[model samples]
Target: MLFIKTFTRSICTGKYSFAAEKSLLAALRKKTGYTFANCKKALEMHDNDLNRAELWLKSQAQALGWSKATKLEGRHTAQGLIGVAVNQYSGVMVEVNCETDFVARNKEFQSMVEDATKCCLRYIESQQKPQENVAKFSLDTEQLKGLHSENDGKSLADKLALMIGTVGENATLKQGLGLKTCEGIHLVGYAHPAGHVENGLQLGKLGGLLAYRSLGEGNDHIEIAKGICQHIVGMRPTKIGNNDDKPAPNKDEETCLIHQEYLLDDSVTVKELLEQNQLEIVDFKRLECGEIVSSIGKQPLEFVETCQ
Candidate 1:
């Protein structure tokens, strides 16, 4: 009778005498990247079972992520990272935004951006055909969010929610782009303030893709291609300048890429450099994390539009 009374009291008071509280909490936290407090709650809710605690935490995390995202979408998200993935035939860029630069610099946040960019690139590679235009295709956020990963079969939105839960911030996949080149064109990309490279993805504040058609034997100038991409990222030109438009003295008004001075030398114009190398610009794209569209009035020859 005394033992039964003690058990009833312990259960009623929510004070189960679990011997592995610390170990269980630590294991669940490691597995799910959840807070210790939440892990403890899950452990308690599930009778001190680590696997059950992890499952509960993940399920709650998904729900919590959406709630946090919806609540925080109204908050300004001006800081984030730009990630790029590219190959010889195609390239892709994706921007993921967060409310704070502190979150933007987080390694996990950067990894999520990288994964999204890579997924977009894979989509481009799979969807692109020989007849496709030589310009850029704007990837819709919803479609991108719906793309299922081959590894785990989870949609991007699902993974993004997980990230949101982990980061505890209002994160958004603001923009995505996939660029394709024509038969004669070559594609190259560069990330400003060259960041740490991982698995061929570039993560940084600004990124640019430059497409050029070799006019002669100059299509494969390694240094020249990289230099041009770097220049595009730094200079922020909107259009390809006319051939007659020569470089003027500090012509800040000249936003055309060809007329802009070479970023590597600055002694000669980009036009001059291209001519010397027998290269002609096919198209180019630059991406920043949270640029205001209304601010860029001087538009490129063709702006990337939403995919139809």
Candidate 2:
């Protein structure tokens, strides 16, 4: 009778182990999105604790994605969207890059860029010092990468890596700039392809921010700000100038903001339009995707990835 009891106990233990193994595999698969073999190995490594296994898989995935992203370093990323986040007090613009326009249009890619822009904006706001302008805040690639997103606590670099993994191409958070307005100053932004929305903020392949002080008494300055923003979107200006200054010899007209013809009335220059509207352009920022190569001193070969 003792021997029969021992055999029955052994059988029950074996059945329970098999059932637990099966359940763990299913849970790991659901959570990690890993293959059955990978999931089973992770469960075995963590002694079949579902939570531990999931965590291990996430870490592994992140490491792998980072490795993949590193391999894509130095690749040209000309195609991407410009993301903008703004409020009454401040506004931010960010350029995120990918290998192709198709990926640029991906909703996931677009969402990440938008989130990154908001993250940059929040970081700038947090760093604001008394009597200092927040508009002075700007981040390069590495600085922008270090910022944490409000949507998830993960750093922007981590988000970019995950996106690189998902899209099977390199991605980058190339540049970011923020602008702030004081009591007398007003900030306005424009994004081309105006239909794109990210986190309820407008986004496009090109974005511009204009900060100006209203010299006029009425709120028509608001309309004037919008008009300047629209002109910026169309003109793609690189620098703002006053009408009194002589044009820089050999300067690209397309890059000079005040030199460009006003979109509202092509007959007038942007500088003339500003003066007539009683607006003075205090500061402005324009972002176009993939404009960083000039600063970095290396022009990468632009290539599109195609499946073999």
Candidate 3:
């Protein structure tokens, strides 16, 4: 009788343990989006506590995702979007790159770029110095990675890693430029035809940022600022003024803002139009997708084939 009782208890205990583990595995898989094997391993590693297991799995996944992302780092990211965000006091531009145009057109990719740009703009707005003239802010890739998204509060690098894992492509926040207005200045941004309009601002493959200090009254300068932005989009000028000493003769007409013929009326130069409106160009920035070459040299054909 004693032996039978002990055997029954042993059987029941084993069944209970198995049932609990099965339940934990299912729950972990659902929460972490991990495979069955991965969930089981995580559960075992963390003593079957659901919260701990989830955290462990997440950390492991991030580590693995980052590893994959590193491998993709050297891949050429020629297709992407330029995003611009503007508010009453500040503006920001960002370039986010991916491996293909198909991904570039994806709404998720577009939303990420838009959010990143807006976040950058908000950061600049928060750091505004009212007493300064033309406060400028810039973020390199690593700094951009640390910025938290306003939408979900996720660090940009974490969001980027998830995107890389989901899309199976190399994506990078290539550049960021921020501008804040001082006293009489205002900021304007433009996106080319390939751009999309949101909140009355344009975002696309090519972007322009212009800072103008108004000298006239009652929103007239606003129109002038926008007109200059349009001209920038059309002309794709490289510099604000003819500051280049030995300017390339052939490229100067198209590359210098003051020298390019006005888009609205080709009869007048941009310099003359600004003078007519009594507005002065404080500063400007232009960013085109994939304009910067990758520092990583192209992989040899043999290496590419081996990976394939």
Candidate 4:
């Protein structure tokens, strides 16, 4: 009778223990997106404390991410997404690259891009130059990664590395644009092929940020600015050339913004629409994911020339 009671208690305890471990494994996997094996390792390391296990897993992921980043550095990252954020007075644009379109569409990957853009937006807010009504600057890759993420206190580099580990891919911050505008300047941005919005930030294949001032009392300048941005994203103009620039014979007149036909109204050019609205573009930036950059050799500070 004594032996039977002891055996029954042991069996019940074993079943309870197994149940607890199964629950912990499932919970940890859901929380951290780590594999079952990793979660089990974390649970064992931390005695099944969920929060502590999560922390340990994330800390361990940093090393994994760094290793993957180094291993995949030379791989051609031909696909990625563009993240652009615009608040009332300032905005930011960023391009984050990965090896495959499959990885580019990953939620974790998109989250990293969102965090990066938000970090840059905060940096732009801090570096506001009230003297310049409109300013455009490129972001240094190292500096951006060193900055703390706005969502969490983790350094952007660590966050990025953790993501690299999680997704098992080489992700890179190819380029970033920090934009600030004065109160009166209408700063707007548009994204083509935009995905779902998260905390006001959107990811897309192509993005455009535009800052312009209304020379006259234009009531609909906001809409006009957005329309121009849409046009900029669609047209891919190289310069804000004057109306006097000649069209290049047969190839659609697209070398300059002022020369391109207004997307909103095909009857008139962008210059004509601007003239009608009494608007002058202060500065603008168009970012397409993975576009070739001939002038990319220059440092961020070297590309700091401000436009009015």
Candidate 5:
């Protein structure tokens, strides 16, 4: 497992408190059945295994009633090293990862993953409404720092070292996805058994999440939500309108949730069917690769300089 000495040093220097470290060590040893002394020694020997060790620690914590198990795996082989996982607590799900598979499965590594996720879920819940009504949301700095507060005991790469040492592999948590619920409106979600799988242009990149206020029966909600989920995952739509003039790239396409043609049925837009059925759409969220895009509208620094 390849670990970044500098990154690990910084995390341990500020975040790893004695209490947290002790808890993590206990959980790691318990889960992997490795002696605490041996686990600590392994971490001391490697720098890249910090995040991996953290995840193993998280897994152990879950076993001890500290958290719940979610999907954890090693990824990004072409790059350096990375791992990813989903953890559930209360009603929240947090995606976590490390750089290597070896560390990801270790007890100490899993503990860190669980702890970090808990901190993130708690922070998000306290600050933001569960409803996705807000247009913008981000993590707070204080809470971010709090998650790393237990980092003081090990070398810069102690966590990563522990991960690598335990798993004998390199890794780190790269990114995550989260959702919450609130009154009035309900949120519906589903994911591929594993994380995401890369495919050509359509089915492979889509995941579904739908949120709307329902005045109908419980079974109705499930049926409707299932239909919508299928539509989203199965159909790939650039825009949801009949008019080519109103392509998804246009501004107007965003305003009418119903009018957007159903990805599953090009014959009618979501708007058209809702009106026909006398249904109302409070809001909806659809995530697709090459669809809901991130507009980082900027040229490279070199390009700007040359043009100037």
Candidate 6:
């Protein structure tokens, strides 16, 4: 048996290549590797080994496939970053970003992101409904085809690609979602006031809705619900609280205290709302794409440890 190798350079990404065959001076097969340097050395040592050269190429391709998979989902890894958040109730919220504010604010691009978020939410919600076999629910790829239209005629991802093509920078969804629970919990959702992805990234610009038990309640429930909205926007608590952790506030003027403040009045906390109306806050959620102000079982204003 003899060893033979050949070397070449790719026009794209400036990577290296190698070729090998049985003959010292005959046509040979090609092999590619991570770097041109490695290919050159391998070619020199194995000048006539076609089988070994092909194996090396396959090994390199497998190694690159792992990195490609992460990007395929448009997730931002530590090196390549993107931001997304999701919870039990509201579904997945993704933040698709570009380099400049000009591109970030692009109407076409923003529409695609919004539509995609809706698709993801709709997909997850559909998955959790009462079913005999829970495993049947998976994202219908066909829905993704519509994304190219960006709610027009293109698919959402295609629209994103158009944005990338127009903007001259890499643009992809940085976030995704999988909810932990959906029952016994209602989710209030917020989009940034601007209806823009970056707006979700900013503070005090979020718009959210409360998904409470659509069952019987009183006018106080409405008022309390409004208060919760305010709390979501103002205090931005991470989770609803039990009574033992902190004393309910005396007055409602404070916007942060959920238990002591009435929805209609900043002066009263949620406690006041409950006492007056005979109600309780089962739980609540606040949606902020970037900075988390508080977490469940925590203080007035604290940052969330992780979006995950």
- Judged by lDDT against the true structure, how good is candidate 3? 0.76
Residue lDDT tens for model 5, 1-308 = 24688878867876766556666667657756666775675445443254577555454533433111112223342222111211121122223344444544456655554444444445445544533332212232122323442334322123443444455444443222334444555545434322331221011123454544555545455456546655654553343333444435653444434445566566876656555444444433344322322431121111010000
Error of 1 at 43 (Å): 6.0
Which clashing pairs does model 4 show?
A: none
Residues 116-232 of candidate 4: C-alpha lDDT, one tens digit per residue: 888888888777555657766777567677779756689888887888878888888777886777777778888888775766687899999998888997477888888999999
Candidate 2 Cα RMSD after full superposition onto the native fold (Å):
8.2
Best candidate (score: TM-score)? 4
Model 1: per-residue Cα lDDT over 60-138, one tens digit each: 8788877777666677778889888788788887888888999988887987887788888887777544453375667
CA RMSD, predictions in order: 6.1, 8.2, 9.7, 2.7, 16.5, 15.5
Instruction: Report the CA-based lDDT of candidate 5 relative to the real structure.
Output: 0.41
Rank by TM-score, descending? 4, 1, 2, 3, 6, 5
The TM-score of candidate 5 is: 0.43
Give Cα distance to truth, residue 150, candidate 1, Å: 3.4
lDDT (0 to 1) per candidate: 0.77, 0.77, 0.76, 0.82, 0.41, 0.43
> Candidate 3 residues 43-157, lDDT tens each?
8888888999888887777777688788898898889998887777788878899999999988768777877787777788787355645666667777678789877788889
The model with the greater TM-score, 3 or 5, is 3
- TM-score computed on alpha carbons, candidate 2: 0.73
Tens digits of per-residue lDDT for model 2, 109-208:
9878888888877875665432422244567788888888776599998989977877778888888777765566778888887745745477787788
**Candidate 3 off by > 4 Å:** 1-67, 242-254, 293-308
Error of 2 at 62 (Å): 1.0
- Output the worst ten-in-a-row residue range by lDDT, candidate 6: 130-139
lDDT of 6 by residue, 1-308 (tens): 12222222233223322222223213223333234455544445666465565556444544444344334444331211222233444434344444545555565555545666665555555554422111111122233434333245445555555445444455554343323233443343444443324423221224444444424554436545555655565555555556555653544333334454444565766656656665545434444434332322132212121111
Candidate 1 or 3, higher lDDT?
1
RMSD of 6: 15.5
Best-fitting candidate, scored by lDDT: 4
